[model samples]
Each structure stands twice: as structure tokens, then as C-alpha cells.
Target: MPSSPALLRLDPTACGLPRRSLLLAPLGALAGGCTPGAPALQGGWVGTHPERGHRLRGELPRTDGPLKKAGVLIVGAGIAGLACARELARRGIDDIALLDLEDEAGGNSRAHALGGSLCPLGAHYLPLPGPEAHEVNELLHALGLAREQFGRTVWDERHLCHSPQERLFIDGPEGGYWHEGVLPPPDGAVALAQYRHFSALVAQAQRELGFAMPTQRARWTAGHAALDAQTFAAWLGAQALTDPQLRWYLDYCCRDDFGAGADTVSAWAGLHYFASRHGFHAPGDEAGEREPVLTWPEGNGWLSQRLAAPLRERIHTGRVVMRVTEGRTGVELMAWNEAAGAPERWQARAVVMATPLFIAHRLLASPPDALRAAAGHLRYAPWLTANLLLREPLLTRPGAPPAWDNVRYGATALGYVDARHQTLDPMPRPPLLTAYRALPTAARGELLSGSWQHWAQSVIGDLAATHPDLPGKVERIDLCRFGHAMSMPVPGLRGSAALAALNAARGRVVFAHADLAGYSVFEEAYTAGVAAAARLSL
Candidate 1:
């Protein structure tokens, strides 16, 4: 078993990131190369468009605008906000309004379309809803993704992710290449045994403690809750699970879901990744094959779009909610309309703050000490996603064909997801590959201060290792940098009193967002929204 410090310093290159460049070069020079007149990287940058959100840090110019009246005002149009609005409408509450700072309302679930291909900016897939997830099941049924057949929910076949679902490339026996799934190659018998042991442990945890979506539903006994007291790496050490391959796979799962490594993530949160889906079985499938996932070319952006469709007229894009004050009869909100170039005001009987917790702290007026302390304890992990439009398919050596998800072992980035993998029609043109990387909390400063060109170069260079001709096959590369991509479920964070305080409603304002769940995921965000709406309805 490795010491805590040893686990903490797993490996500098474990994330598959390139070494820091010695020379600091300008954006133009770095992107197009040292040679002048070379064409710049074909794509531009897109994100949540942080300008208006940043403006919340300082006071805005006072405006004499009349306050608009609303029965409910939801301050955000992300998944949580949209879910709140949708739930309100479902309950026959129509006098509600939703606002978002981004031009589009999906938040990180936003999608981009280029040359007839659609790709995701952030979240891309959702696991099959558990039996206890009633709201989620209902939402899926409403969206035509699911239906009741003989008292069992049946998911749409077309929407399910097709196989050859995932593959991994590692330096090992078969010319340093292994195919099928993200697990370690079969050559590592000891690692495989450890993985099996770990799986049994997760199953036991699920049976005993109950790890499932909407985290609020999980049975948090003193024994299970104790898991949050230690780091995942520490737990691994205690179990004597010292296989390097096993550790790497576990670390990858942490980075992929929580945007942090095992050493920084909580044992409970890490185990939740496995236990949460313990009994998740797709509709009409009893063979116990891999659980099916609902996905589209645009990823969860498809679900986001559907959630926003009914509330389109009620959603106000580019409206930044700067402040929220609880009044005797209702809640008052001051916002700045980027499109109108002026201040806007709203008064609502109830308000749901579906924004991130960090933003909620800034917007709330005279927040309670508990809320403030809870917000302070919350940490966010940054992520970078680049969509590369290729003029041709990636050149492959003899092995499995291009899978929907391609992972490179020992690389900083989590390889790339092929955006065209779900296309029904025959692709007559090149494909669009969406590459993803979750920057460790330590690298957040570097990502923020670095130029887009530098990040772009890092992405291309990383992929070049897997596909040698990747550079020349690329035509456009659009980069999406999420400074606070997902909430990091560090040790002592999940199931903590701080998180409970953060989730509690304050006066007329109800909090909603994935962060409240202590681990960011589609189900948590949606559930948070629904929970907030239920509170507002009451």
C-alpha cells in the first residue's frame, strides 16, 4: 500500500497531458507556427460567455426601470433552471420566468453544429435512470425516449448508445495496444482480479448503503457516511489494491466524472461512481449486458434542448441576475440585459436560484453564515473540450475500428468522443471528434491564464500521440474552456453538514444545481431542479 503523499503524487503524466513548454509564445505564433502567413486554427472559442457573470462581482449602474411581476422567477436557464420551469409548468403554474447569462440556456449542456455535425460542449451522456428515479423516468417517457410496456419501462432503441461502445489504447502486449472497454488489458491478471474484488465491494456497498442518483435518495447510514471521511486513494491503500492498472482505471473514472483524481476525491464519491449504477438495467433487456445509455450526436444537449422547448417564451437569455433580495411578500431580483444594454428588475412570490453555488453566494443578499460557509467549502474543477473537424477519418493501425469513446492510457486527456458515431446516414464527409480533458484543481490557474492557442496546441499534440496524421486531417478546432466545469467532491465534502446547509432553502430563495448534490451529473441537476420546484409549489 502506498502512503497518502505517494498516492497524491500519482504521476505528472497520468492525465496524458504534455509537458510545460519552456518558451512563452504569443497566441498567433503558437497557433499558426513560427512561420508568418500560416493559416490560423480554423475554429474560434465558445463557452458560457463569462462577461456578464463576471460583472456580478461589482455593483452595476442603478436603473430606474419598473419592476416586472412574476409568480416565480428562476435565476438560471441551465438544466436545473429549465427543469424547475418545466416542473412548475407541469404543476399548472404558468406565471414563471427563467433567465440565463449565456445566449443559449443549456449551460454546460450546450451543443455546437458545424458542417451538418452536432457535438457537445460539456456533458455528453446520461446513464439509464434507476427504478427510484420517478421524475427522470417521467421526463424520459415524455420525451419519447421511454414508454411503458407490460408494466416495464422500455427505452427507445435508436437513442441507445451502439456497440463497440468504448475502447482503450495502452502500451502493452498486443503491440502496446488493447481494444474493447476502458478496463486494463487481460494480460494483467492480478489487476483483473483486483478489479473483480473492487466490483464485489461496490456491489456490497450498494446493497448495504444504497448509492444511487439524486444522492438525496441514497441511504446514508453512519457506516456508509463514514466513507466520506477519507480520500479514495487512502481507501484503496487500506484495501491493499496496489495494482498500477487498477489504480489508473480508478483515477480515470474520478477524473472523468468528478474532474479530480482519486487522491483528491472522497472515497464515498468515488465508490458512488460504481455503486450508483448497481442495478441499472435497460428496458426490455434481461441478459445483463452492459447497461444502455441514451445519447445523441449532440449529447445531453439534446435533452437540454427538449427541456427548454416548452419554456422557450418564458426563458430570457443574456439576462444576468446580479442580485436577489428577499422581501416581505416576495423576492426581488435585479438583472442586466446584455441585449438591451440596461438594467432589469423582477419581483416574484418565490425564486429558485438554479445557478452554481459560487454564483448563488454572490447573488444572494445577506446570505446566512451557514450558506456562506458551505459555499466556501465547495471547490470547482476546470475542464477543456476541443472539437476537431477532420477532413478524413483518423488513420488507425490494425486493431478495433473507431469506437464512440476512444481513450488513451497514460495520457493527460481522456482521448476523444467521435461526434459522428450516432449518425444514421452514411457519412460522405469527414468526421467531427470531440476531445475532452479535465484539468486538475492545481492546473486551474494555468488554464485560466493561458492563451487558447496554447490549449489548442496541447489538445492536438495529445491526440497526435494516438493518431500521427491527426494534425493534417484537422480543418477546424473549436475550444470550450469551463473554468468551473464541475463540482469537485473532495474528501469530507459529500454527505457533509456543509453540503446540507448549502442545499437548504433560504427564505423565498430555493437553491438548485448539481453542486448541491456534491457531485455534478445530469440526474443531480435535474433532481435539484425538481426538488426546488416542489418546494416553490408548496
Candidate 2:
């Protein structure tokens, strides 16, 4: 592995600037002291519209604008909010208004067009939904991505991730790279045995209690719930699975899904990562077979666009919802319209807060004790994603062909995914590589304090380990910083009273978001939105 560039350290107090100023700082300022003639950052920064979110910290200006009335008001036009709107429309409820802070409605699932390819800025793939994931299954079927076959759900083959799905670049290996699957090369008998043993355990859990997505459908027995009390690392220790290769592979899985490692995530979540997939099969495969994942160039952003397409006029983008208050007649909401530069009040019979718990806590007026407790207990992981527009495929050692998902062992990043892998046409000359990195162990303060250029350099440096010539082949690197990317399923949090409290509807205000399910998977977000809509009907 190549060594990383020297880390750049910054002091906000010394610079006499607020932490947020770093996020908006010019790349040139971050590149200060760089060697003359060094490669300058080619692309600008893009993100989840942090400015609108930052406004939440300050009080909004009261407006004299006329009140707008609606039967239902959905806040935060992410997957959860869009799902709520879709469900409401399906029930013939068109008096619904969906509001979002960003110009786009996908939230973290947002994607950007690079050349002719669409690359994801956040979420990139969706696992095949199990039978228990009714909402997800229904959504897929509606989207024409799946079909029922012989009592099981079968995903369309074209959308399924192509073969040679994954590859790992291992350090110190004979060839330094291993092709095919996420499992490490079988160099040692003990390591191979440990890997099989762990797989057996996951298979057993799936057979007995069935790890269902959205987590709500999973059988939550006392024995299963007890896994939430300890870290996944501790569980592995108890099981005596101490192979370094196995540990690295498991850690990669945790980071890929939860943005945290085994030491940080709850054991139950770790187990769920492996066992939650059920009742999905390939087009011609029988039941219980491992189903191929469904993906597009834009990832779940494609799904989000489909969900929001029918309700474009009803969905209001660039609107920050400031507050929600309960009244005798209905729920009243105060939102700041960025374009109009004024606060607008809206009254609705019911409101679905399809946002993160932290934002919901800030927006709710006089929330109940349970809601407050739930908000306090929740924690989020920060993430950084960079879409590197390469002139050609990345330079690689002779091994397997470029897989859809590429990973490197002993690296900080989870590796890059080929955005054009799903394209029916031949791969473009300048392929887009969507790189991902999660700051699982870093403090939120640290993540917020870093400049965009700092993150870009970090990503480039990490990628240099495998593709040393990556900096030269890159056309532009679009960086995105997610301060509160996804909710962390820490020990003792998943099945706790706090999560349950957060999921429950308070009066006419129904809470929704992937965080409610303690995992930020597509199924969780979809389920939360559908459930929130159902609650409004009740």
C-alpha cells in the first residue's frame, strides 16, 4: 500500500472562524503550503445542502405570509417523505405538500450526472427485499424492478449487480490482489475455517429467527435482543473468531452498511447485516437463494426520482421546515422558503416528520418526554463521498476484471464503485468512480472542522494505494461531506425504549426516517415513510 500524504491540521480558534466556515472555505485556502506545480483540485464541492440544515440552529424570522392549508404536510423530501407522499396519493389524498431543504428531493440518495453517467453522492444500491419487507416489495413492483415468481420475488436481471461483483486488493499477498467475492483469499486453513464457521452462525440465525429488513419484521426474542447489549467485537470474542482476515472482512461489512466498525456497532446490527436478506432470488432461481442486488447508475437516486415524479408540483424544494406545533384544529408548521426569502405558515390535519430524529427534535415545539429522550439517545456517523471522473479505467495490477464494487484491504476507505457498471451500453472512455469513506471513529467536531480540500486530498491519497496514477487519470473530483450521514446502531440502542419512542407517533405528528429503524438501508427508509403515512390515516 502507498503511504498517505501528511495530514493537514487546522485550528478554528486560531483562524478566528466558525467551524462551518471551514466547510465553505475555498479550496485554494486549504491548498496553502502545497508544493509549487502540484496538482490543483479540479472540481468543486457538493453536498446534502448543509446551508439549509445549518439554518435550523438559528431562530427563523416570523412572517406575515398568508396561511397555506393542506390535508397532510410531509417534511423533508427524502425517501421517507417521498414514500409518505406516494402512499397518500395512492389513497386519493392529493392535498399533500412535501417540503425539502435541497433543490433535489433525494436527500442522501441524491445523484449527480457526470458526462453521460449518473453517479451517486450517497446511497448507491438496494438489496433484494425479502417477503417480510412488504412495503419495499410493493415499491419495487410498482417501479417494475421486480416480479412475483413461484411464490417468491424475482428481481430483473439487467438491474441486478453484474457478475464479478467485488474484488479485494490485499497487502502482502503473493500477487497483492484477490479477485471475486468479499471473502479473503484462502491462504490459511484456520482463517478459511473461521470464515465458514461465522457464515454458518449467520445462516443459523436466519433460519431460526429470520433477520428481516426495516428491523420491525424481525423476530425480536429475548435472546436475539440481548445482542444489542454488546459491541459486535465483543460477540466475536465470545465466539472465539480471532482470525485477522475474518476480522477485517467483518469490519468492512459493518462500515459498508452502518458506517461503523465492529467495535462501534451493536452485535445485533452486525448479525443483521448478514442474516437480514431473506426470500429473494434471481429471475430463474428457487426460494432461499441469495438474490442479486438491484442498482442503477444513479443508485437509489433513480428510485427517489421515480417516487417524486408523480408529485413534482406538490413537492416544494429549497424549503426549510422550521417548526411544527399542534393546535386544537390541526398541526401548524413554519417553513422558510429560500427562493422567496420569507417564512410561510402551513396548516394541516396531519403532519409526517420524515426527517432524522435530531432535526425532528429541533423542529418540534414542546415535544413529549419520550420524544426528547429518543432524540438525545440517537447518534449519527459522518461520511465523505467523492466522484472521481477518470479519463479511463483506474490502473490496476493483473488480476480480475474491474468489478462493480472494488475494495482494498488495510485502507481507510471502503473502496470505489463503478457507476457505469449497470449501463447497457459499453463502458465510457472516462468512467466515473464513486468513492466512499466513513469517519466511524472520528468525533463530529473533527469532521465538521475539516475543509473540503482536506477531504478531497484524503480521498485521493487513499485511492493512491491501489491506483497510484489515479490523480493523473482523474478529470475532476466532486466532493460531498455528510456531517450526520447515517444513524449509528451503537450497543444497547437498537431495541431500546428510546428507538421505540422515536418511532411512535406523537399526536398528529408522525416521525419517519431510516433512523427510526436504527439502520439507514433503503428498505428501512421506505418502510418508515409508508408506516408514517399509515399513521396519518389512522
User: Can you give the TM-score per candidate against the true fold?
Assistant: 0.90, 0.89
Q: Which pairs of residues have clashing backbones in candidate 1?
A: 15-411, 15-412, 16-411, 16-412, 17-412, 172-176
The runs of at least 3 residues in candidate 2 whose Cα sits more than 4 Å from the true structure, single-residue gaps closed, are 1-40, 149-152, 173-175, 278-291, 441-443, 504-506
Deviation from native of the Cα of residue 456 in model 2, angstroms: 1.3
Q: Write the per-residue lDDT of candidate 2 for residues 79-145, one digit (tens) a residue.
A: 9999888988988889999989888888888888876678898899897777788998898898898
Top candidate on TM-score is 1
The 10-residue segment with the lowest total lDDT in model 2 = 5-14
Error of 2 at 16 (Å): 38
| lDDT (Cα, 0-100) at 385 in candidate 2 | 87
List where candidate 1 sits over 4 angstroms from the true fold: 1-39, 172-175, 279-289, 502-507
